[model samples]
Target chain A: MLSKNTVKFIKTLHQKKYRNLEQKFFVEGEKSVLELLNSDFEVELLLVTERFFEQHQKQLNHLRAELLIVTQKQLESVGQFQSNDSALAVAKMKSNQYFENTQEDLVIALDDVRDPGNLGTIIRIADWYGIKHLLFSSQTAEFYNPKVIQASMGSFTRVKFYYGDLKEIFKKWDCPIYGAYLGGSNIHQLNKPKPGILLMGNESNGISEELAGFVTNKITIPGFGSAESLNVAIATAILCDNFKRLAGE
Target chain B: MLSKNTVKFIKTLHQKKYRNLEQKFFVEGEKSVLELLNSDFEVELLLVTERFFEQHQKQLNHLRAELLIVTQKQLESVGQFQSNDSALAVAKMKSNQYFENTQEDLVIALDDVRDPGNLGTIIRIADWYGIKHLLFSSQTAEFYNPKVIQASMGSFTRVKFYYGDLKEIFKKWDCPIYGAYLGGSNIHQLNKPKPGILLMGNESNGISEELAGFVTNKITIPGFGSAESLNVAIATAILCDNFKRLAGE
Candidate 1:
């Protein structure tokens, strides 16, 4: 059974202000809940339907957090999704960590990536390409946004994200900065990729002029058809894949 | 002003059944509206705010449809998005037409891609890559789905799609069929990409075994990081980019 206060708290997580104020976010659905349980993230509470508790008794006992068994109707009341999952969890937000000045790895930087779904997809793409450090402009969507968390699937557990001023960070960096644009040099024709920062910009707007001026290499995916522009997330995946392929070769 | 019947009609278009019954779908936002107006698509009706009509009188006159100027509140009530656009249009759904049997060119076949957003992104990617034909399993999200239309951002105008049984289609096709899978041969290692169909499968469950058996070439996007899987749309973009790059070379 869920207390009235607990229900309010779970509901509060839907808003960015409340999520930040409480320093907690909710993970709904069985797949995300299971991933959270196995991740380094600290789980504050695990709420499950009575049937789920009975079915997964062995797994439930292994958890270090407080477990509460509630009726299906009760779970539905606190759940954000229309189809209530067997389990949901409240995870404490991890503090942002900056990496040491390293010169041997690729990193991704986003400039005002406003869409939560696009941001999440980009994180998942970064994870796929083995890019560990993701730096977002202060204007990027929050990492804990529920839509982002859901769109990322479970990649959030593996990818580290930091929200800060990208311009200041790039000014201090010695490695090359690659920015994707429409008429830039063809990505396929570029030399092998090295450890650098790959910058992606907003949905409607490409990289800001201020940041574009700082970029060492401007590249494009080379479109053949009449699309106005590729979706930012799709473009990110293509860029990351090309970078990895060239680096590996 | 929008009549009560007109409002009800637009609202009903949100559902697949009503859309199919009426043989029309809605496209909102200024860019998408303009794209449809310029395309070969038959525009049934155009709804615009008086401000938009006054602002773009020249362009509005080019549209060969009944244009109705409504108030902002009326547009908002009938609009799909919270932040409403200046114009919206109801486009007549055209029947899928297949060209005469000819040597296969590069095409894409989606197998039960349930997510409308993914389907839309894939269509946009197809348009960007200049792949003219996209085939979808009947189980795949409909091309006219509002979410799909929104994500495609009007690429639906350029890309032609056919809905049918993929298994039967694969059996009849004599050209190479590339199936994207986890442990398949690294796509970068494949020397040549013939004019063939690139099959992208469901999000959770990849290509069904029936379709998998018919795949002549199995390829993967070669992940280096800890992500369990790439989002279907991201994977499609990467695959399409690589395929076009190699084909062009």
Candidate 2:
């Protein structure tokens, strides 16, 4: 029994334009909503079904956000998930901040990786490999896109995103920048990888010409078959795994 | 313009039942259509815009399929792509056949990996790593799903799929079965990987309990962060990369 105005307000957060204007976004589904509640993010509202509320009364205790019991149909009507029987949250967006890389840090930077699903999967991959900060070119998909949020699973809570001019940011960094390319040195055979930014390109295009100029080392995951190229997210996971393994050794 | 019946027939192929009955599926987008034309699979129809026909006349030469000049709108209406200005092809599905693993072959098997997008991405990853054959449990997503065909990029033309009871198939194989798990031997530290079947599990569930018993080596991608687990496709790519790198070394 949600109000019409409340549903409209929740639906507006799905678009990037409205999300930016309000500096807020919504997270849907049970696991993501639970992660949102536990995260440091300031939750403004929690929309949940009676079943969900009853099952997690202990976790809902001391909750600061306003909670409203809604039907499963109501949750499905306004959220991105086709069936969200549990909860959804409206959370405040964090102010944009650039990562200050230390010598021991391995930063991941993207040059206009525009797909929301790819961005989300990369965030999950980053979280798995213990990467805290992700730098994105200005043209990359917005961090608050619901597709990115859902695709990221719960890792969005752990990983941070900073979007700006990649060229400007790379100019200020001193460590080696490993750019993924089709014809670079084989990643498996490279000498120990150092802590640096691992740059990935757009879905169709490789790294932009301007970004290419700043790459200190060019690397590739050798392909033994006929795939033109790996999906951006898939390639990112492979590269991150190799870097972490090489650096650890 | 495509006939109403032709359009209706093509749309039916989107579902598994119709695809199975007719033994055909449609491929959309420019790259995949071009790949389909070059592949060995028989093509029943080629719907192309005038511009596409004019540009690829040389490639279209000696084409045996029924060719029709259709508008982009017609293509979009009948296919899965939101915008496909180039071409679409209705191609015959290959007869289902299981792989006969040789001593040197490295097979990839999935236990109920049900998502079409995940299956497609895994196909692309398999192609990149030169994995020629993929084995799937009966519950896995159909190989002819349009999402799988599109997400696979052009690799669907290069890789083969076999679906059946995984338990029955594993009983006949003598090679080691490597099952991916959350807690297992570190993949990066494993002794040089031997040729074998690598088993990936469903999206939410890891390797099935029954399938776990058939595994000779349990392997895992060690995680350093708080994310629960990797996406099935991303994990497959990372595992395949490790295996190829280790075996090659």
Candidate 3:
């Protein structure tokens, strides 16, 4: 059972303004909730249906948060999901920003990736390629958005994302910045390009002119067919695949 | 100005049942409408705002459809778009299915890819890779769904899709069949693997068990990071990239 205020608060978290104010975001579905619990991120409150609670009895035993076993009907009222039969977790946002000196050799820099689904898929791609750090331009979609989190599956727990000014950040970067473009060096011809910052730009617009100056090498995934361009996330994965293939990371 | 009957008929096109019955579908946005007009697809009607009419007067001059210069407000009500400024096209569906012998070297076969967006992106991917034929399991989402068509971004005109039983289809396949899975040959290691059918399965449940026996080679994208699996469209793009790279077509 949930109080009126509790349900309202959960609903408000769906909006960026409220999420920023509370410094929290909601994670839904069985896999996402389980991942949130297992991750280092702090879980404030967890609402689950009996089915979910029963299935995860062993894991639920040691949870530190307030676990309210709610009816499926009650869970749906507060969740973005139309029919949630599993769980929804309200988790604290970790503020481990400014990781300028991270261990990961390759970093993906996104500039104005506005689509939530695209951003989420990119996160999943980053996780698959073992690229841990994601630097997003301020214009990019919010990483905490439910659609982005859902699209990322459980990979959101593994990928680290930071929203900041790419122009200033790239100006001081010490590594080679590879920018994806239309008429650049063919990705296949590269002699195993070095590990560096891979900059991806907007969906319709490629890298903005402001950050274009910082790109040391312009690379492109050669297209063999008639489609104008690849989706941002799809392009990102292909670039990551090529980069990882070369880096042998 | 749209008549009440025109508005009601356009509204019906939004539903798959009515779309199937009418044998017509909607194409929105400037690019998609322009593509539909240029393609061999028959245009039943074209609705455009004053701005679009003036801008594309040359193309509009040759169109055989019932062209209605609609107000932006009127266009919004008749189409799926909230505030479309350019154009919306009601295009006649082409029923050219029996292409068991297309000229395109590679074919994409989807098995129960239920998401409209995934199917649309796959169609776009197929177009990008120069793969013209898309074979779908009967359980796959309808290719003509507005979301799928919108997401495809006019690639639906170029790529050919067919829905049929895979088990019977694979029984008579005369080419190599590559199925994507968790454990399979590293995509990079394949020394220019032969092209046949690239079989992708459902979003959650991968290639069906029935079709697994027919797979000549199981292939996988090497993952350096921790993502459990790639999105169907993203995976399809990477695989197509590798296949085209090897086929050198």
Top candidate on DockQ is 2
Q: Model 3, DockQ value?
A: 0.86
The deviation in Å at residue A114 for candidate 2 is 0.7
Model 3: colliding residue pairs: none
The segments of candidate 1 whose C-alpha lies over 4 angstroms from its true place after superposition are A50-59, B100-104
Candidate 3 lDDT score at position B213: 91
The per-prediction i-RMS, to one decimal, reads 0.7, 0.5, 0.9
Rank by TM-score, descending? Answer: 2, 3, 1
TM-score of each: 0.96, 0.98, 0.98
Which 10 successive residues of model 3 chain A have the least lDDT summed?
A96-105
After best superposition, candidate 1 residue A22: deviation in angstroms? 1.7
Docking class of 3: high
- Per-prediction DockQ: 0.87, 0.94, 0.86
Model 1: per-residue lDDT, tens digit, A9-84? 8988889999999899988877778778879999989999877788778877788888888766677778777777
Ranking by DockQ: 2, 1, 3
DockQ of 2: 0.94
What are the Cα lDDT values of the candidates? 0.86, 0.92, 0.88
Could you tell me which residue pairs clash in candidate 2?
A: none
lDDT digits (tens) for residues B132-154 of candidate 2: 98999989988889999998998
Q: Relative to the unseen true structure, what is the C-alpha lDDT of residue A217 in candidate 1, on a scale of 0 to 100?
A: 90
Between candidates 1 and 3, name the one with more favorable lDDT. 3
For model 3, how does the per-residue alpha-carbon lDDT over A1-249 read when each residue is reduced to its tens digit? 688989999999999999999999999899888888888889989999989999999999989999898998888889888879999999989884867835347899999999999999999999988889989999999999999999898889997778899887877777889999998998876886767899999999999999999999999888877889888899998888888777755
